[model samples]
Target chain A: MDIPTFDDVLAAQDRIGPHVHRTPVLTNGQLGDLAGASLFFKCENFQKVGAFKARGACNAVFSLTDEEAKRGVATHSSGNHGQAIAYAAGRRGIHSTIVMPKTAAKPKFDGVRGYGGEVVTCPPGTRSREEAVAAVLERTGANFIHPFDDAHVIAGQGTCGLELLQDAGHLDAIVAPVGGGGLISGTCLAASGFSPATKVYAAEPEQADDACRSKRAGHIVEDDAPQTIADGLKASLKPLTFHFVANHVSEVLTVSEKEIVDAMRLVWERMKIVIEPSSAVAVAAVLKNRELFAGQRVGIILTGGNVDLDRLPWAG
Target chain B: MDIPTFDDVLAAQDRIGPHVHRTPVLTNGQLGDLAGASLFFKCENFQKVGAFKARGACNAVFSLTDEEAKRGVATHSSGNHGQAIAYAAGRRGIHSTIVMPKTAAKPKFDGVRGYGGEVVTCPPGTRSREEAVAAVLERTGANFIHPFDDAHVIAGQGTCGLELLQDAGHLDAIVAPVGGGGLISGTCLAASGFSPATKVYAAEPEQADDACRSKRAGHIVEDDAPQTIADGLKASLKPLTFHFVANHVSEVLTVSEKEIVDAMRLVWERMKIVIEPSSAVAVAAVLKNRELFAGQRVGIILTGGNVDLDRLPWAG
Candidate 1:
């Protein structure tokens, strides 16, 4: 199916309202001065399971009928999406399994288990995990829940933009970090529906700016080895998500790794919020392309806050 | 001067509304599971100057007339309050002089300067910093802004509770870490005014539970040997604050150093907030006494987030 429409996102908001958090919107005056804009931070870092993934997870799980959910669910993600789907599935009292890279964060690995998902580890950077999850789903008759590519997931992710508009009201633009394009696709639908005057923009890490290049050239582009601190945005955009993003997102911007680190530090030091590098991508883009957002009220979605602090950039 | 009453706190809230943050509140189902209670965290860690100290600082600065502010504002603090008063005074175009212990965190020292304050460094002792500040105030005719002793400071501190109750609504109890008793005194007054059924409790480190002992004995007590991971709660309470706390607060609970560290880690890991040891005191209290708060809605004041990441427990 094509990407969910604005009507679909509104329906997703209704479907996911009971599951996800209505995370707070925050503003820091001192930080605002540095941005040279009135910035409202929609703190998805405080979202359930500590990222915007919960929106997609809830939409995917709830989209299933009781019989379909009873067949169980499964997914492959070493990060936020794994825990999100696990947490969402657990809430429905359904059996769920997550295929994760063996080298995933210990906290995240434990988080999925803590939320009652059966965890299966696979070799990192291999199709082994995906194949293993597909085998498990077939063997157990469990449904394979896509991390971001699924229509339900995009619709679910859109609920974040819906909530942002509900809380912060109108914004000149909404800037979101683009991964598989799930969040931005959802954000676009919501912004288009609620604040039709608002523009939707995507922030991609420079190392993983294939999505930006692809969007400009009107074709899919392979990742440039995908080496970025923003592990969440490393995924190649799916065709369905790319279609929505290409049609709806006003612009896609990129920022360097150094900018991501600096933005992460500023958020930790000034905003007192601990966000992962993936989350910092949005802030990095704002800072890198300051002219585009300066003097315009913008909503910057701080995506996640699950970074390992023991080796956080500021620690050294 | 006496400790400010609820009426006084409400007045201060009105006075300082323009200067201070009605700091956002947050919650997570994951973090609540650890404490075995639903929690509402008033994130004063996001307050101006990175702590609840901003409330009192703004109140103290604005309470002064034009002539009084022209003379300058002076205070002695380990860190947060000093930065707060500095920021507040700077907002009014007044000079600020902060006498801090030489051992205070480097970020805090930078914050004072960053906000345009003169720093007077003294040896690591309350006596040394107090003596240096007193001498400086006498010599320069700067107003001595007592960090948590003066009624205006306490009234200003109470504004945090005012903000908490506004959003957190009715709760079984509100928990805060007590040091000089300024934050707790204000919290108690606000709690009493907003929800008469709700109780106010103070969380203090067992190593420096002078406030707890004082509450039990109905008298102010100074600790000659104070030690705690929560450095912000190591000070002795003054007479005025002691009296208000004795009358308003329901109980003073103490937590072990290990619990403080564990709570700080839990907040950082689960709640996704960069809370300091001092702010962790209340979380420690809740986890330590789960039965008292379990199944009941509880509000916790996350007082600050200024700990050096380099010195984070996981790193060192």
Candidate 2:
């Protein structure tokens, strides 16, 4: 697997600079007091398509050659990735196809469609999703963009970390939620070059602790549909993402589902910004392991803000 | 009656500059398209106390003379005003007595206390509330800071509009929700001096339409405890606030409870920001009167972001 370098991150930053928002870095005094850490939150929740996926998707779509661009892009995702791919493709004035599970939420389907992506649904399984994407690529001759496994996508995601280091000045540590490890691995690579002293950490749900287990086992570990409220973090790490996480990440912290929910509510109540469960995972890790971060300046990436308003986790 | 002039607003801006946030102005393309107008939202929801009440409260508290401040300040309120007084007083290192109704939510009581205010609970009624404040003033010789009637408070609230005009550049009209008319009155004064051509309008709940009727009758109209989901807007206008509304406000638009809730949800879903129902009143007005605002650049003040997570209006 080809690993993304710091130069690649800088190049991606230059290419996708005009497309994505350089989202604000926010801090809450009350939340800081609770965690016993001076916390700086890089708000990717305010990103276009409402997630950091925009950075990676835009980089991938924009990096395509003229011949590749004619066929457009295809991605298998039912969440923010699908929306980001569609939005990025739309910005490029290209046709895109999104393969989603039939069991995905209606808003997710709507979000992809709203961004101008043609959606194809399959049965709820890895095999089905892969088959659907293969069929779309075969029929349409579209270039398939893996959600988190592509080198261009990883480089694009690293820009988020590069920005955090630039905006936040100095951080003792940086924590990002690990899903398929795109964001976290990118963060690891960004920190490696931008701020060598800054330790990179990954936060994950205990229910879906494949990344955490893999770190200890010294290999890629996959879970068979392990469930968690952090719906964005259910995916296991791919070979490309695993390589970066294994080498550059300092630690992988896991938090209980209850801890994740509590952290999510704390941010909503204190910061007054809507963040999804995946973003809350990094906060949960900080709050749960206060000893490790106490009295230190730390940065956490707020990954996304897309959630069903009708079904808030805390609401009765 | 001492009506606050635009000069007082400018003075308040300088005095409260260090205490209050120079809140950001945001826009949404999708919402603008839906409204048929370009919308600029002054995000006072992200204010120091999570409400624009901080602007007025800070101005009032900081304007107090050293001798006068020694006796501390007192106010009769159970909502944002109560919390604002507490927060402002805390910032000034002075004692603040907030007289709240016993029927008020526990969180409101906690909010005031948490901000270092002395909470004095009275039996729920205007008579009891007045008596409670009177007793506190008589016992402690604290200066009574009338929530909306005071000149300093009105001038302080005016800073919000001044900031909106300064940040948003050119607005055809500015809309704010009318509660006791403090915010709307402030907007009127700000526009009169800074953006004279910009019309100032008020949005009010149909249930609490006393402001609308009062504007028509050319006199103050009191509601006998009007009920609405917008708890912050239940209070009727006082003479000081009524003067500004009658002389400067262009119109008072009223919206139904459903419209308010729908607008509130639309903002939450699209903007990914938490806003109170009172703030939603302004957005509802812009949506309800699309013809008046179509193709025009309109400014809407999002008043606050203080809401109970468990008791969302749309939640079961």
Candidate 3:
């Protein structure tokens, strides 16, 4: 398998530049004081579809050949990625299908549909979702766009790190939440190519600590039915992402469920921005181990701001 | 009562330039579609102290003479204004006292105190709060910084409108929530001075529709104890603000409590920004009166993002 280089990321950036938002970098004096570090938050929460997934999905859909795009694009995600692909495909005037679990939240399905994507629901599980997607592919001949594992997706995600480095030059470290590791892997590639001295760290929820365990054990570690409030960070890293994580990532840190919620509330209160729990994991990691980031210029990737309004974690 | 001129606002902008954020103007395609207009949101929600109050507060604090600065400043507020004044005073290396009703939420008091302001709790009511503020002024020789209805404060609030017009030039109309009418009054002054043809509108909650009623009645109609979810917009218009509203404001629109909450949720879900109910009032007005603003370029001032997270209107 060929790894995506910095040049591929630049090409991906050009492809998605018109489609995706160059999301702003935000900072708060209160947040900085609390974390004991100068923090620059790459606010992908404000990105199209309210997540950084839009960048990768835009790159993937736009990268498709005219003949390939004519058939349409398909993905299985009850999350930001599903909405992102739908949005990207809709923007390009192409049909898109999203395969979601029947048990998934109504908003998730509605979000995809709102972006003009057709939704095909299956029973709740990886096997069921995959089978449903495959059936749809066979029936419609739509191209399958993997949520995180594709080279184009990683290259697109790398644009976020590139923007961060450009906006806040010479960061001491960069932190991002790790699920399937698409964002962090892309970040690592960007950092390696652009600013090799800047360290890249992956943050994970303790309940969904597959990435942390995989980094320690020197291999891909799968987590079956992992439970965490950070619904977006539940997936296990794939081989493509694991390869980059093993080769380039400086560390993988894990924080408790409570800490993630606390960090989410802190950001909302201090920065007055709506960040989802997955984004808070990166903040929680920094807050938990303050010494590592103390007195340094750190970049934090706020991955998304998609949340169930009726069911806020703080409400409990 | 002296009305602040556009030149005063320009000066205030310079005074507060180093202290406050020239908040970004944000636009959402989905929100625009919903409102049936091209909308430019002046995101004072991302401003210092999470509100546009910071602009006024900074101007007020920074405008004081050296002797006046040494004497300190005081205000009676249980919302964003208190925090803003405290934050501004702290930044100016001066003391601040915030008088609040004892019945106010603990978070409000904490917010004021967090900004290094002395919190003085009084019995719940206009009279009691005034007495408490007066007592503080007498005791400490502190200048009373009115939350609104002051030339300096209105000049500061006008900076928001100045920035909005500068960023999103030639708006057909600009809408802002009216409480004490500082923001709308300032906006009116700025609009009248810079773009005479641009109409200025005020949005108010039906529960706290003093500004709307006052505009129609041709006088200041005080709502002694208005109750609204838009806590930041409960205050009635004072004479200074009433002058601007009567002479410069084109219209005042009121929306139901449900509309305010719905608009808040719509912004959070679509724009993915944490805006307070007061800010949502302007969006609600645009959404409610779609025909009036349809196909027009509208600038909506998102006044603030200071809210008690645990007591969210949607959670109930």
Q: What DockQ, between 0 and 1, does each candidate earn?
A: 0.72, 0.79, 0.86
**For candidate 1, the TM-score of chain A alone relative to the native chain A:** 0.97
lDDT (10s digit) by residue, model 1, range B1-316: 5657789888998999888778777876767887798899999888777899998989989999998988999998867888898899889999999998888778779889999999999998767877898889888899988888888998899888878888986788899999998899888888878787888999999999999889888888888768777888877999988986698888889999999998898888877888989999999999899888879889999999887766776567
Q: Tell me the native contact fraction for each prediction.
A: 0.88, 0.62, 0.91
Please tell me which predicted candidate would have the highest TM-score against the true structure: 2
- Indicate which candidate wins on DockQ: 3
Distance from true location, Cα of A74 in model 1, Å: 2.2
DockQ of candidate 1 against the true complex: 0.72
Check candidate 2 and list the clashing pairs. none
Superposed model 1: Cα runs more than 4 Å off: B1-3, B123-131, B192-197, B216-219, B245-247
- For candidate 3, write residues A218-277 as lDDT tens digits: 988899899999999999999999998888999999999999999999998888889999
Worst 10 residues of 2 chain A by lDDT: A307-316
Backbone collision tally, model 2: 0
lDDT, model 1: 0.86
lDDT of each: 0.86, 0.94, 0.93
In model 1 chain A, the worst 10-residue window by lDDT is A307-316
Candidate 2 lDDT over B140-182, as tens digits, reads 9998898898999999999999999999999999999999989
Candidate 2 C-alpha error for residue A195, in Å: 1.4
**For residue A246, what is the lDDT in candidate 1?**
82
